[model samples]
Target chain A: MGCDIIVEEKHHVASRTKNKYTKNEYTGLPRKTGLALRFTGLWEGRCLRQFRGRRLAWAGLVAGVLLMAAGMARGEFIAVLYKASRICLECIGVG
Target chain B: MAEVGPGGMGRIRRTVQFAALLITNGYWPGLGRIAIYSGPAKGVCVPFLNCYSCPAALFACPLGSLQSMLAAARTLPLYVSGMMLAAGFAVGRLFCGWLCPYGLLQEALALPRARRVRLPRWIRAPKYVLLALVVLLPVVWVSAGAGVPFFCKFICPAGTLEGGLVLALGRPELRVNIGWLFAWKVAVLTLFLALMPFIYRVFCRTACPLGAFYGLFNQVSLWRIERDRSRCRGCGTCVEVCPVGVPVVEKPNHPECIRCLECVKACPYGALAFTMTEVGKQGSGGTPRISNFKVRNGR
Candidate 1:
């Protein structure tokens, strides 16, 4: 009975290892089979495409914050404050 | 979770829009005195277009600030650009749907049950042109003092209605300065107001440079609409319900979609949804994808 239990454990380990290697690292689709052996590149491309928008958004948000900080440091806020506070003739469609 | 219907969502939106209007222009003390709010809040730019010259406006308009910054020093308007980028990247034109006072007014106009027609797709191009040529025109022809804010001076109906009319009514002294330009602006404002009932967001779809600017980020905005193709029957309900005419099933995150969420609520199959994150399991391509695991029974 003990010997049979050991054998079952070994089979389970083998199957897990097989799955780890057979699945694509990114997409988890079946990796390469027959002529489709070049699918590694395709899987990587798909992975990148999936997350591109999210990555770009984060990068843009960071860039915006930094730029805004720089502008504030340069007293652009003061300029905006002065301009916004005053009633401009242009804003009122005058002249 | 109990999902809110289009009616509930619309009421929430109107409430938010009204609250935003009041919060931004709540200073009633100087409402009829020609004395505008000159507080520290005026430094911060509001995402949607609100005329700063209005007596009660407590914050700056981004478009106005952008033009002013550009026309004055001709340097990159880093501050305004940064603010716009942050807002756009975060939520795209969500401001247009839920916050813009003008959008609210347009919706109110649209509610009167006029001849509503789906605007041609080509109508989306003019705002971009206005942004490129008119908004940026002041940068080149900079005058001596504060440079000319071209869009405000010549085009903006909000400036005419909120700022010009209010100030003119309040202060008789300022009305003397009003001439052909004011008349021209009034005509333009009247045209837009008249068209709003029939066409639905006529100014926004065709001429709002601010909307045009924010629309660019719709593809990559953090907040987005996703359609579950697994359940979507392609019944055209979403398309039928969309106020901005976004072909929801075909292109869910179309630039014109203002994220009004009417499509999501109106979809009988509960296929469309608003998602905050677009990272995992979502498609960056125009058509959103569902994972194989998520597609029940290979349907």
Candidate 2:
């Protein structure tokens, strides 16, 4: 009984594939291959589209926060301030 | 309330550049100590390409700071990099457009009525090479105790102008140290200045490593130019007006765009607009709110 149901499901998918290929007659791809390709393209597009609005904002925010944290932890920010505060005569070749 | 043209923005930018130059080099007019401003403010890096060696400069050049930091101990240039990152994220190469003294000089020189020539696209590659050679190589060489701020020492016209020329003019004692290096830099500056009337911002388009560095962030910077596809007529007006020759209809935020907003003002169809996203404005969708309605109103 289980085997029969599984076979029926496969048959249903094959028929749907054939119908799609027939509707777009110019594709020339085999039914299974065309279905697979379409599914892949759709999946990729969906993934990329998800990165658009809120996700991008979050990513930027996170990156900024992490960079700040790193800057602080390394005392890099202080070092920059210290360097900028002093004069390097060598930089001007005056030393 | 008259509709301002790109020329108006150019005027505004020129004024801002002049103001910045004065503020950075403010101490000289008073005649107290005309040496490099070795004050506390020197710890901060200004966004423009002002040379720190200038006797009147109040802030450090980020590139010079970066090279100095790197040459010290392969020290991670946290302050310079962080400042650059912040500036890049905030406004990208808008610094080049409205703040850089050198850019201002180029703009001023370009005012002469000359037959303008468009630079070939491939010339854009050399700035990246310069960034690598002048910035990255020195960083690597720093580990060997051979690291020098090669670009500033050899190639920077700002240093030559503000540090070399200004110092020589003001002090005259420093002229004894003037050698072939100074002459070479003067020659380079002369070549760039002569070319400016014919090719707008030739140094910026070809060899400004600092501009190149900021340009990398143009694509994702909070400050951006947007083209409303709905309004565009594909007339190519923006391309004609762009100083850097960016094809804005195709790529609205081309890295080469200095964010001078000439295209924004030049768009006949009211398609191009400047916009900015609020920092930390969460979940606001990637949609940028229109910041400049003038372009939209097409006045």
Candidate 3:
């Protein structure tokens, strides 16, 4: 009933959805299983469900930073690094 | 993880810098044609504004760099800057929402706080007045022959406070020339640095002119937050987590909101979201109770 209420309320934006997954949508994984996979880091989902908690998000963020640092110090594709920083600075109008 | 693609507006900055390094004597070390002059982008001058004083910044920021440019040229390209001002007037601080590295830095610092500090109703307007003083005042007053860039010299936490000032500090001549306004900027920075761990992005809420500009875009922004009161149990997680003190439940589309989507992330019942009005139609309660976020007297 709650989900149905939400679905009904969301008719405005949902109407815009050109759902490719219509008939035989059952072939797609169930909501629970998809959510579980997302929590397990097999795929990205909503932020609330992403890592189950802040600890894991911290863990992921730290690991990602360390990996980037290691790669950056070695001068691994300096052009790519330069380009990314440039883009980061430039996106706001100047870099 | 939206992997931002290449071949965007960014390529120009990188390409120019790279070409400059190659053509100049520094990087190439005795390459042909040593005289490499790298200045602000002239073709499309922007007056809308940003923290262009950043060392790596390529474009001239309208608010911060305007006096110097006009003083240098005397005859300004009045129409070019007009387009950017039009964009700002139409959309407001949309640039801060979409752009602004300093704003991004505040967001990053705000991330670790366990809870957010909601601003009192009284604090929101100071930023608008600041925008007028910093951006507008200089344009009007500088004609009287003020040598210093009024906004950059007096206020701008970005220019006087950030890494640019730190880098500039290394030169003794620059350090000696630093005045009271620089001290004020440092004091503001010191306060923000002190407050960031406790509250989040307080500067963005209270002081940042760029943020003030961007807040104007909140209602019309393509990416925005929406609340579903039907599902909300009024848990207050969204309010508790918001760094900018946005009253999510009461004013989801409030102009002050950066549209960071932190509230959307905090809503456990999927009551809040960053959306372009996906499902909110036919009797949909977009404002939720949790967004009001009041403390219980019992607690």
Candidate 4:
């Protein structure tokens, strides 16, 4: 049973979908890894290792979207428009 | 990372900067008359420091929007924060190097042959202080029933130049309203103008709250600079070329780096590079090493 589970795990890992760097729709290899590969060619592994925390960037993108939605829902978008459309004399050092 | 030779990279940067300026402030109603754009686009905040009241500005300044929203509703500025975060993470301070019209003006002031003022590292602290005041003063004043965009009124030289000077030139009658406050603002603008040539983006390095905010994301931004320790010789060429005086070899992802790529073009070993993807390259590092990368003069 343990051997069967090991086989299933290996299959699952192998069955992962293709990413941007994948060779083909089904194959696994870099088709377009990063600019580092195109540029230095030698700095490829370091480039990928340096980006180990790229998941943080993705999370930030999602959080930013969510915050924008919340702010718009609360009518902040109109508030921004109302304020931006008019010239506040104080802002220009006149008032 | 194909080395766009010195002239090539500079030409590309200048073109991008000029294009950004035109795109942000392109609302030309007529040649003579000046009018603020109040269209639906004004609701959207552009990533840089273009003033809202500029005759042709199509979008709101994020700093101005944040302060106004905080003062009016006395609540958290979720929208501006999110917008800033998204832009910061996506491109970091690329906007400062390539998009900010104010930065363009400073660059024009910076003559290539002129001597630069070597400011102490402590000079980097004030922008954060200004940012703090920008966020807090609005809430503080609003709670007391005197709502105001504090930084816009007191400190923003961009507003003074783009909004005040431009509007004053177009509307003769508005000149009558100019008082001590206007004079004070002009003085502030003058100080910035005088210092810029000597300091190389002094306003951006020491005063711009927007730059300060975006600087925080330089480390985690989607687009980033990477330095290869194995390849770098610690020659300090990158440090000398950096406009913001970032110690590039020591800290390739420093907060102050504007990513102008001057260092990348200047490096003899080609130790520095920028990447746009997250995928790592795994292989028998192809391409023979070029120990003496030829960096032509004027790089």
Q: Write the per-residue lDDT of candidate 4 for residues B198-299, one digit (tens) a residue.
A: 777889999999999999999998777766554555566777667677878667778898878777766655556766543223322332222333232222
Model 4: how far residue B213 lies from native, Å: 0.7
Q: What is model 2's DockQ versus the real complex?
A: 0.09
lDDT to native, each model: 0.77, 0.66, 0.46, 0.77
Q: In model 4 chain B, where is the ten-residue run with the lowest total lDDT? A: B289-298
State residue B277's C-alpha deviation in candidate 3, in Å. Answer: 4.8
By DockQ: ranked, best first: 4, 1, 2, 3
Model with the higher TM-score, candidate 2 or 4: 4
lDDT of 1 by residue, A33-58 (tens): 32122213234455455456478776
Docking class of 1: acceptable
Per-candidate RMSD vs. true structure? 10.8, 15.8, 15.7, 11.7
Clashing pairs in 2: A84-B42, A84-B43, A85-B42, A85-B43
* TM-score of each predicted structure versus truth: 0.80, 0.72, 0.55, 0.79
Q: Can you write out model 2's per-residue Cα lDDT over B1-299, one digit (the tens) per residue?
A: 11233434565656777898788767574234546666667766788788877767777788887877777646566556766777777667989988888887777777433313567889999889888876576766553356777787677777777776666666667767767777777787778878877777888899999899889878776656766564555666677677777877777778898887767766655556655522123322332323333355563
- lDDT (10s digit) by residue, model 3, range B1-299: 11111213123323443443222213221112221113423222332334343334444455544444333233332332343334443334444544554544454455454133556777777878886665445445544464234555555666544333533444444455455545666776677766665555566677766567657755544334555555555666666665566677777767777654555555555555554332233434545443244444222
What value does the lDDT take at residue B49 in candidate 1?
Answer: 92
lDDT of 4 by residue, A26-80 (tens): 2233343332343442344554554555768767878887898898898888889
